[model samples]
Target: MAADDGVVLDEGAVVLEDAPPSNLDKLENSPPSNLDKFLKRFRALNPHFVRDDAEKLVCFFGDSDISHWKELPRVRITGDEGASWARCVNVGVGGAEMLHVAFYSAECRAKYRPDVVVLCAGENDLGAGAAPPTVFSYLEKSIAAFGHLDDATEQAQLRLRHDPQRTRDNANVVSSLPIDDTKSQQQDGMNASEFSRLRNNNTDEKVPIVYLCTKPEPVADAELRREYERYDGRIKELFQRYNSSCQEELLYFIDNSDLRDPSLYAQDGLHLSRQGYQVWDARVRDAVERVLLKMDERVLAP
Candidate 1:
């Protein structure tokens, strides 16, 4: 009936002029025609930041799947007992991997300084046909980068406390450190020590890291499904490795792989419907409760 630009179309590639701009905008904005807009809307539903009524902060970071995280209406809060957090920011971007997370972490903490971050990634890494160790290696680097920032912040804070005037003079330089960049794209400059400090703080009281295993994915049997499955197994293995390296009380993992109901997915066997999102919402809440338990143990243990 109409060409994409709102010009009327006749059968043989002929287009009629005089189409209204109003009509043109609608056609141009159509979901199929404007994938960027659709993706933006989809990602926006997952806010990257939300004010926390409770003192503690929580956030989600990863790729598209995490971008859709806020679609889950409710979130579970630990330590508060009866309290709950509304929602935090969703920083997921399309095709983001652990390297992206590592890079973004340097950016995110510099900006928001959220106390808790919920990550749902590895999907993109696995989907890209990465080997297990290769993906985990990147993830390891990313985690280290996160700790690196924590170390910098701690050192800066300590220096400020020791000599407020001296710190004031040097604050610019300290803040200018590459770890302070919140712009996501600027973290490529981090070096090895910068990376190791991120993991070194595993048991540090100030900056505790929580890594959630990826959610369960549908077995779509697409051309890339087997490849995806291989990566999925790798993800679990990484979690196991991280958990084993430390006492369970220090580093904990909650398995929400089966949280979303199989029925909630779209027929394509890959994304989710609104109902499916609700299931994920519930899963994250439960997982948070578990994470809180671990945190409490770490804090309360003698």
Candidate 2:
């Protein structure tokens, strides 16, 4: 959660803002987007995803769990001798709710029609009191929002135009607050060529989307854990129906039953410690490898 302090620290991120220390004075609301500050920091840290080689990228979107799994990409790429197999980018933002997932990955989603997109959200959404149906609605919105490659472009535009819950605390920050203005604001202008090319090449491409079921963590109470279970059940039930009908598999549901044990989590009770991360890393790697292998077989077939 954001606070009066100038430093916004998540389990894996520390975002600094140049604001007055005194909340006794007039308060300054954060930018309208839940992901504004985090995105700024990410862009500064990893500009190459947008600028340089992002071939065979597997982009992950979630909260701190994904963000905190900072080594997943590098460790694999190192083993593969510097991404000969694939590269990765983690666009997870700590404290991000379910609704924020798609928007957080929109740029990469648009730019690199990644070989795979893995989503690891929903626990935070449920913990925040959203019903299972509501959390699922956010997932549905994300799935629909990126049905086509062009939809990613539209999502970026829509983000600029509309931010939900804007009427209450929406105050324009000073121009000096560059973090408030998205990198999208600076980069959307150069995107005409990129998008135009994407529009032509991928008019009908259906990218694979993987939804990693919500994990039971220590932060949520018993009722919240139950809600997490309900959300996961809803996800499994709905995707099973979708998978059964579709000839070509586009949606995948990965279960997290192995992660139910409390010992897997760190002492903080939110993030996964090394032991828990071992489980998470395996889940992510297995999903990515399966997607890549499927792609390889298709390309090599007569």
Candidate 3:
């Protein structure tokens, strides 16, 4: 069994702020009423369907894992509790791959300008027999979509607004300090808060991509070990490379790979159970807080 507190990290904003209103209410107060109404109506009319940006603009992409996450709406909101939030619209299709995430165009990011993007994949890529180079190549293309310059016209409107005096100890800095460079390595020292600021702030840098890493699962079978060895290892390596390439640019990774519970799996020793989801949720909350803190430090820095 993984430690009882395996999911708990040393520093993170655990106390969630009041949950934001449903996406429907947010849309009620926005422009292009007709478009918003159409989206709301469509989601309301269909079962097992999800929608995005009813209030704020945000985009999410992955495969089945992310796609299913939409079904579980957040009861408690983490990160910058009161700042601003966006309803995630999963572009994930079950059994999708990294290449799918890269090759498949996400109109939402272009249209809504999300404050953050949650990317989860690779399992499917390995299942599909993707080579190591192919996997890394896909990630390279995907990250590049965020633009590759400190000052780019396409990403000029991004901003990192923060009220420094509000927090007691500038919680942002506390959350963003590098943890383990070897374990969660990346280019530059950009932590969670920095990524959040880049996404929310008015800057010329491309949209900050938060690379969410999958947790380590129990691999009792040789086949499972082989699968994990190829896909999981490649994903981590590729993320490190991306981080190194964009050290000064706006790019970062969130290591949730440490949030798994070995005992939560079934006899097959693969996949997360309900309890496992709880563990993953905690890590997600931490990443959100880190992003907020990074953004706050950048905006309020003296």
Winner by TM-score: 2
In model 2, what lDDT does residue 114 have?
Answer: 71
lDDT of 1 by residue, 139-208 (tens): 5444544452343432111001112232211111211211112432332433445433333444553334
- In candidate 3, how many Å is residue 39 off? 19
Candidate 1 lDDT score at position 258 = 53
Q: Root-mean-square deviation of each candidate, in angstroms?
A: 16.8, 13.5, 15.7
Per-residue lDDT of 14-63 in model 3, one digit per residue for the tens? 12112221221232354222333323322332245443534432355665
- Count of clashes in candidate 1: 8
TM of each candidate vs. truth: 0.55, 0.64, 0.53
Clashing pairs in 1: 47-89, 47-90, 48-89, 48-90, 49-89, 144-198, 147-198, 148-198
Q: In every candidate, how many clashes are there?
A: 8, 0, 18
- TM-score of the candidate numbered 2? 0.64
The models' CA-based lDDT, in order, is 0.45, 0.54, 0.43
Model 3 quality (TM-score): 0.53
Model 2, range 1-302, lDDT digits (tens) per residue? 21222323253232223222222022124433445665565455455646344457777877777778867743233323444556777777677766555444555567556767887876665555455554565565566555533444432221122223323111111111122235425533223354342231332455677777766565555665556665665556445444444434557777665575778977666677788878767777877777666665666669
TM-score for candidate 1, residues paired by index: 0.55
Instruction: State the lDDT at 281 in candidate 2.
Output: 74
Q: After superposition, how far is residue 108 of candidate 2 from its true place, in Å?
A: 3.3
